[model samples]
Structures are given as structure tokens and as C-alpha cells.
Target: MTRRVYFDHSATTPVHPEVVEEMCRFLKDNFGNPTSLHYFGQKARKAVEEAREKVAAAIGANPAEIVFTSGGTEADNMAIHGVAYTNRNRGNHIITSAVEHHAVLNTVKALGKQGFTVTILPVDQYGMVSVEDVAAAITDKTILITIMHANNEVGTIMPIAEIGRLARERGILFHTDAVQSFGKIPVNVDELNVDLLTISGHKIYGPKGIGALYIRKGTRWRQTLFHGGAQERLRRAGTENTPGIIGLGKAAELAMANMEQEAAYLTRLRDRLIREVTEKISHVRLTGHPTKRLPNHASFCFEFIEGESMLLSLDLQGIAASSGSACTSGSLEPSHVLLAMGIPHEVAHGSIRITLGRDNTEEDIDYFLEVMPPIVERLRAMSPLDQETEFALSDRCNGCRVSHTCRV
Candidate 1:
């Protein structure tokens, strides 16, 4: 049987063995609710708190500042909506980027319908948001600025620290959806100067149902999504997910211990894949900032074919990749992030994201390099746009007077 290769870490990752062990222990032996106040409950409570501390340490925040949620989407929604509603008296305006995740986009749109004006700052060709544009968007009515730290589709690392500084100077709250960047790169709340940050455990090799939000100390925000419990400092109300939280804690700890080493390794593998792919494949272009992007993310768009077809082909070859976010996969719409980066709709439809992870190796990259080009060639051959490309190349060669004269 042929071994399968996974290159879609940006979408999700397999749970680490250590994390699974910890989670299983909790699930099998310690099944007490954290809210019960008994011995078993105390055990569960302690595990949850310790997990909180681990997650906080990963992002350079205090344990108390961390609020565990369902996942990154919920965390982003909580951060954006919480700040918006709590500070409604202060302002009715919010600022975000044109390339935000749909989680943020839909929430912002909902707020827009409720009369809150949202200013979406456009990115340059590299999918980077400008600090100057963000500064300009701020007004007396500006309540919050929510921008993703690293774009999920294109992997562009925004200038979040600069934006945070500007937001601080204007007394506006700033939040970053660090779901893609959190485990892959280092994030410090104070250094970034952000009031709120969102993270997901599944992106870090933990359980999928658990995530956390970082609310800076003294940051004022009201809970937008409320349930019945005293959990998460009353900010997020739900019974604690002990097994998931334990797994998340172990994942965070492992990430902190190995981030630098893993980053360097993944960088090498990702760059090798990119170089080989771009060199061997024609009619393909890289997306996102060349240097200032995630170490593990390599995104590109091959002209003509739909991303779905490319993804299906890759899967048939036992290579797992993604067109865009898992949430928007079924939609026919082009990725907003690629579109925001000025990539044409036709090219955007052919976009593919290949994200490396700690478990991947040079052997895996070699297998992908061996298999990917032919697959792409086959897809391109089936594309109607290939005929147009051939025509254009022929026309260019025919129009070259120097070539014609030399031939004569």
C-alpha cells in the first residue's frame, strides 16, 4: 500500500501522541466537571487552569487573560463582537482588513447591519495591510481594529505590531486572529500591542474542539456569546472540556519547547517544495509576501483549472492540500484573500495551499516534488486556457523580429 502525505497543516493537523495520551487519561479516569467543587471537580479544575497557563505562556500572556472557546472561529467572533457591543457607547465604527477570515467577515457584516460601520483596509499585491491605511481609518468613533496576524489562504504576515501601536495611540482596541500564526510563529501580546488575540488548538496538533482568546489585562469587553456557567472567568460560559483542554495544554507546551527548531526545519522543507514546484511547473505564481510569511505555508495559483479540481487530483495521488479555508471549501467563490491580493478571479480559482508541519520530512517533500509536476501538467493539459496560452506564446514568438531574422 502507498503511504499518504498530508500538506494541509493550515487546515488542520494530526494530534500529537503526547497530547493524545494526556487527553485519553483525562477522558478515561478523570471525567468530573470542573464546576462541581468536589475532589474530582477540583482535579478537573486544576487541569483546566494549568492548560490555561500553558496556552498563555505560548503567547506571552498571563493565565488569567486566556479564555478557552470552541475554536478559532468562535474565539474570533467573541473578540470582535464582544469588544464591539461592550464599547458601543464609545463608537459605532470598527476597522479590519479586506483579507480577513469569513469568521471575522460574517461577524463584521452582521454588525454592519446593526448600524456599526466597518472600514475594510485593502492590502497591496503581497496581501499585506498597511499601517498608514489602518491609522487613517481610525477616528473618534473607531472602537476596534480586527485584523488577522497571518492570512490563512495566502500566508501573508501583516504588520500587526505597527497597527497595534497606532490603535493604542488612538485608544482603540486591537484584536488579531492568530489562528494560523500562533503555533507556527512566536506571538507576544505586549510586543504586538494587541488587546485581544485568537488561537486554536487543532492548528497546533491538539484536539479540535478547544481554543483560546487572549484578552490583555485591563482590556474592557463584554461577553457576546453567553451560556450558563462560571467558566472562563465568566467571559466564556460553558462546562470545561477537560480532555480537550489537557490535550491543548500538552500541545502548547510541546510547541513552546520546539517552535524554533520546528520553524527552521519546516522553513527548509517549505522553501524546497516551493522552489521545485515553481521551477518545474509552468503558468504558476506564488502568492503572499515572499519573505515575510509563515515558515510552513506555501501558496500558489496555477492558471485556468479550478482549485477544486486541483485539490481532487492531489488527493487521488495521496497528497492532501486545500483550496482555502475549510469553512468555505464548498463555495464556488474565489478565495477573498487571493482576490484581495490582486490575483485575477481565473487564477484565484486555481489556488492551492500547501502547509508543512513538524511530522513532515524531506522524504515527504521529495515525494511531492516527484508527483506534483505531472499532476499539474495533466490538469493544465485539460484546461481550455492552455490552448490560449499556447496561442499567446506562439504569437509572441512569431512577432519577434529578431528571432524571425535569425531564422531567415
Candidate 2:
């Protein structure tokens, strides 16, 4: 029998059955537009509001602050563009990290075309953004500081709390894309002190095409995206995605309930996998901050073999994994996150990310461990690249803008 395992929760999770059950009421006989004034509409509206409350509770936020959107991408755009356009008079400068999701990086780039000065902060070798660096980047024209709570590719948790504190002190709006970290770890709006944050449903075993953006009260933000019927309290303008909202709410509730236990379980499995893989495979190094990364994430760079080859080989063995962020997996270019972490072009191409989830277990890890060694061995044996080419780091990183020191 072929062993099957899934280790790509960071990309997305199977929609939890409970979430589907919660969404059923909105989809069937009781279906009604939440915007209508009729009884059916009121009922749908009530359920949507209830879902809003649950999502807010999960993140220690007020329900009024949560604005539903199509997913993390839309939420991210709403938060970043909203702040940039509304606060443009305050400052035309925006600050972000190099390892941010393209949703953020590209949004700021668009803002730059509109004459807003943009700063892309570089990361350390571990893919962690620096607090002092953020402080230094702030000038009189710096209005918004957006960084992700955790990286999608390497899973390194950023110092969002510290950065948020600094942003608050500087009177700059701080936003974080928590799409990959919301359910997998703690995400309190107050604890992180972020003025805005983004969360997605599918990442947490909920329906796709639904997400929320947290906008702190009193933040200078306006509708930057659409012009339609007043929905999401005039923050986002569209008919509400009632089913996805309800599913996401249920998923949030369930994740909060099971977080502590699940985190511990995944941590143990992650540590074991990290330990065994490095011990078994020669010339491999773990990516991301070893201690500051997500509890369920274990990424590695295997010398002399490209990540696409390893992914194909693993898929043949009935294991699902990824080279990096599922969003940019199709890009042949090395991960910007890995390159930002100072990984050379050659080694970054060989990176693989394995993120465990609530459904994963010891048996799955065992099966993966059983197959991974031989697969990596086979891939390396077939490779024409040698250690000297694979191991050389300085040549590629020199004069590259991805790393902080290298850019300097």
C-alpha cells in the first residue's frame, strides 16, 4: 500500500467538517441576501453578525473592527491601500520588510508609482525583521508600517508586538498579514498592538474565498477598493459572503479551542522531524529561525538537488509538501524569503517546507521520514550539480539587495 501524508498546512488546510456544518444553514433553504430588509435577510444578517463576533473574539478584537473580504489577498490589499490612500496627507512614505507576502510587497510598489516613497526592509539570515531597523526607517513622511506576523514560506514569526509598539509610539499605522499564523499561533490585536491585521479562512480549515481585515477604531482609513452596496459596515462595499463568513467563524472558534494542545503536539513532531532529517541527510541546513518559527513548520535546504525535483519525488511517494509559499510555487526564481535570509541562489532552489497540521500524527511523520531519506538520496544521486557549486554562498549573496548587510 502507498503511504499518504499531508504536510502543507501553511498553504491551505482541508475545510474542517465542523466549519462546513456551520455554513450549511446559510447555503440551503434559508438562503437570503444579508442586505435585504425582509425577514429572511434579517435572519441571514444575524448569522453573519454572529460569525463576525466569533472571528473578533478569536483575535481579541471588537466585532466592528472586522471587515470581511474575499480572502487574505483582498484583506491585505484593503488594509495596505486603505491606510496609504487615506493617510497620504499625513505621510507619503510606507515601510515594509523584504519577506512580506507579494500582496503587501506589490501593493506598496503600486503606491510607490503613485508617488509614495516605499522602503523594503531587509531581513537577517534567519528571515526575522529587526525592530531597530524599522525604527530607523521611520521619517516624517512615513505614515504606514506593514509587515507580516509570520512568513508564509519559512514560517519565522516576526516581532510584531515590538514593532507595533514602536509604530504606536511613532504615531504610524501598523498592519500585519496574519494569514499563515492566525490559527497556528496566538494573534491578539492588542498584544501585537497592530492597527490593522489580515486573516484568511482556508488557511485555518475553513471555506476558501473568505477572510477578514482588522481595522482598529480611530485609525485613519477609508474605502480604497470598491464602490458597491454598503456592506461590511461601509468598510468593504459588497454583498457579504455569508456562507464563507460562517464557516470561517466556526473554524476560528475551533482553532482557538484546540490551539494550545495542537501546538504542543505539532511542536514535538516538528522537532523530531527537523532533528531526524538533518541527522539522516548530509549537507542539509534548516531554514528560518530555529526557535522563532511556527510550531508546525520544518523547512530545509538539501544540497545539490532542486526543490521541484524533491517535491515531484515526494508526490510519487504519496506525500504532499511544498518548495515554499504555495502562492509563488510556480515561479522558477528562488524564494525571495530564502534569498532575503541570505541563502545563496543555488541552495535556495533546493529548499522544501513541511508544515504539519491538526490532522497530522506520529504515524504520518514516520511514513514521511521513511520515504524522505531515500527520495533525497535518489534525487542527489541523479543530480549533475556538485557540492562546490551547491555549497558556495558568498558569490550569490554579494551585492544582492535581499540581505541587510549585503545591500549596505
Candidate 3:
């Protein structure tokens, strides 16, 4: 059997062994509701609080500020909708970037339908949202400024700290969907100056179906989305996902401990992959910012071929990767992130994202480099556009302008 290599860590990572072990303990022995009033319940409650502390400490936030949710999507929805409704009287305007995850973009669009004004700020060619544009978009009516910490597709890091500081000065609540940046980058809520932040467990080698939202203490936000028995201090309702939360806490602790080393390793592999792919392949262009992107990510666009075709070819060679954001893969449209960065639809259709993980090594990267070039060449040869270009070039001889059959 061919060994398969996974380069889709940005979509989701495998749960760490430590995280799985920690979760198993909770599932088997401590199977009590945190809300129940008994010894078992107390034990479960203790675990839940400890997990909250771990998550909060990971981001330099207060334990009380972390509210658990289903995943990044729910976390984003909670923050945007929670603040939108809670502070509707203060203002009904929200500001965000065009390259944000659909979690934030769709939620804001839903709010627009409900009569809330929304400003979708554009990004630069490198998929970077300018702090100046964000500053200009703010208004007295802008109640929330929710931008992502980093773009999931191109992996371009945003200017969250600058935007956060601006939001603070203007008295507008700032939120960041940091699902892709939390474990992969140094994300301190205090450093970013954000009032609200979102994180997902699976993105950091924890279990899926569990995530958290950081609502700064005394922030004017409310639990307007979920309505049920008090949980997450009434910020999110329903029984706690005890096992998933425990796994997330364990994962958070592990991430904090190994972040520096893991980032360096991934960065080396990521840059090598980018260097080799762009240098060896013709008509290939790196997609995101050259140096201001994620340490574990390298994305690119190959002319004269479709991303799906290259992905299929790579899959046949036991290499797994992604064309763009996994959430929007079902759509036939090109990536909104790429398009927002001024990438033409034709170019965006051929984009691919390679995100590394803790388990990736130099050998894995070398294997990818070995298999990827031929796949791109194969796809390009099969492309109708490439065929047309080839015929056109053959017809127009370089040596002589008059002769149509000058083979040079």
C-alpha cells in the first residue's frame, strides 16, 4: 500500500494522542453532568472548570471569559449574533473583511437581512486586510468590528492588533475568528486587544464538535442565540461537551508547550514546499503573502489547469491536499478569499493550499515535491486552454513573422 501524506491541516488536524487519552478518562469514569448536584457532578464540574482555565490561559484570557461551543462556526455565530443583538440600541453597524471565513461572513450577511448595516472591507493583493481600510470603515454606528486573525484559504495574517486598538479607542467591540491562528501562531487576546475571539478544537489537534469563544470580562455581549438551561454562564446553553472540552484543554496545553518548536519546523517545511513547487513548475504563482503568512501554510495558483484536477492527480499519488477553504468546497464558485485579493476567477480556479502539521517531516515534503510537479504537468497538458496556447504559439513562428510553419 502506498503511504498517504496529508497536507490539509488547515481544514482539520488529527486529534493528538494526549488529547484522546484525556478525553477517554472523562468519558469512562467522570460521566456526570456538571449541572447536577452530586459527587459525580462535582467531579465533572471540577474538570470543566479546569479545562476552561487551560483554554483561557492558552490565550491570556480570564477563565470566566471562555464559553464553549460546538466549533469555530458556532463560536463565530455566537460572538457576532450575541453582540449584534445585545448592543443593538448602541449601534446596528458591523465591520469585517471580505476575506474572512464564511462563518463570520455569512453571519454578518444574515444580520444584513435583519436590517443591520454591514461593511465588508476589501483586502490587498496578498490577501491582507489593511488596518487603514478598517479604520476608515468604523463609524459611530459601528458596534462591532469582527475580522479573522488569519485567512484560512491563503493563510495571510491580518492586522488584528491594529484593528483591535482602533476599535478600543472608538468604543466598538472587536472580535476575531482565530480558528486557524490559535495554535499555529502566538495568539494572546490581550496582545491582540480583541474583546472577543473564536477558537476550534479540531484545528489544534483536539476533538471536533468543541470550540470556545472569548468574551472579555464586562464586554457588552449577551447570549441571544442559544436559549436553554444555564450553561457556559448563560452565554451558551445546553449540557457541556465534557469529553470534547477535556480533549480541547489537553490539546491547548500541548500546543502552548510545543508551539515554538512546532512552528519553526512547519515553517521550514512550508517554505521548502513553496520554493520547490514554484521553482520547478512553469506558470505557477504563490498565492498568499510571501513572508507574512502562516508558518504551516503555502498556497499557489497553476495556470492552464483546474485545482480539482490537480488534487485528484495528487490523491492518486497518495498525497492529500485542498484547493481552498474546505467549508466552501461544495460550491462551484472560486474562492472568495482569492477573489477578494484581486485574483482573477480563472487563476483562483487553479489554486491549492498546502498546510503542514506536527507530524509532517522533511521526507514527507520531499515526497510531495516528487509527486506534485508531474501531476501539474499532466493536468496542464490535458487542459484545453493549454492546448490552444500551444497551437497558437506553434502557428506564430518566433524566427520569422511571415512563415506560419517555422519550427523553432
Best by lDDT: 2
TM-score of each model, in listed order:
0.94, 0.95, 0.94
The collision pairs in model 1 are none
Higher-TM-score candidate among 1 and 2?
Answer: 2
In candidate 2, which residue ranges exceed 4 Å CA deviation? 388-408
What is residue 227's positional error in candidate 2, in angstroms?
A: 0.5
Tens-digit lDDT string for candidate 3 (1-408): 987999999999999999989999999989999999999998999999999999999999989999999999999999999899999999899999899889999999999999999999988778888889988998889999999998899888988999999999999999999999999899999999999999999999999999999999999988888789888887888999999999999999999999999999999988888888867776667777788899999988777788898888888888889999999887889998888876667767888999999998899988988888878877776877633332232211111222232111
**Could you tally the backbone clashes for each prediction?**
0, 0, 0
Residue-level lDDT of model 1, residues 1-408, one tens digit each, is 666999999999999999999999788898899888799999888898899889989989999999988899999999999999999989899999999999999999899999899998899888899999998878889999999999998888999999999899889999999999988889999999999999999999999999989999888898978868778778988788889988988999999899999999999998888887877776667788878999999988877677898889878889899998888998999998887876667768888999998989899999988887888888777877643333222321221212222110
The alpha-carbon lDDT assigned to residue 181 of candidate 3 equals 96
- Clash pairs detected, candidate 3: none
TM-score of 2: 0.95
Q: Candidate 1: where is the Cα deviation over 4 Å? A: 386-408
Q: How high a TM-score does candidate 3 get? A: 0.94
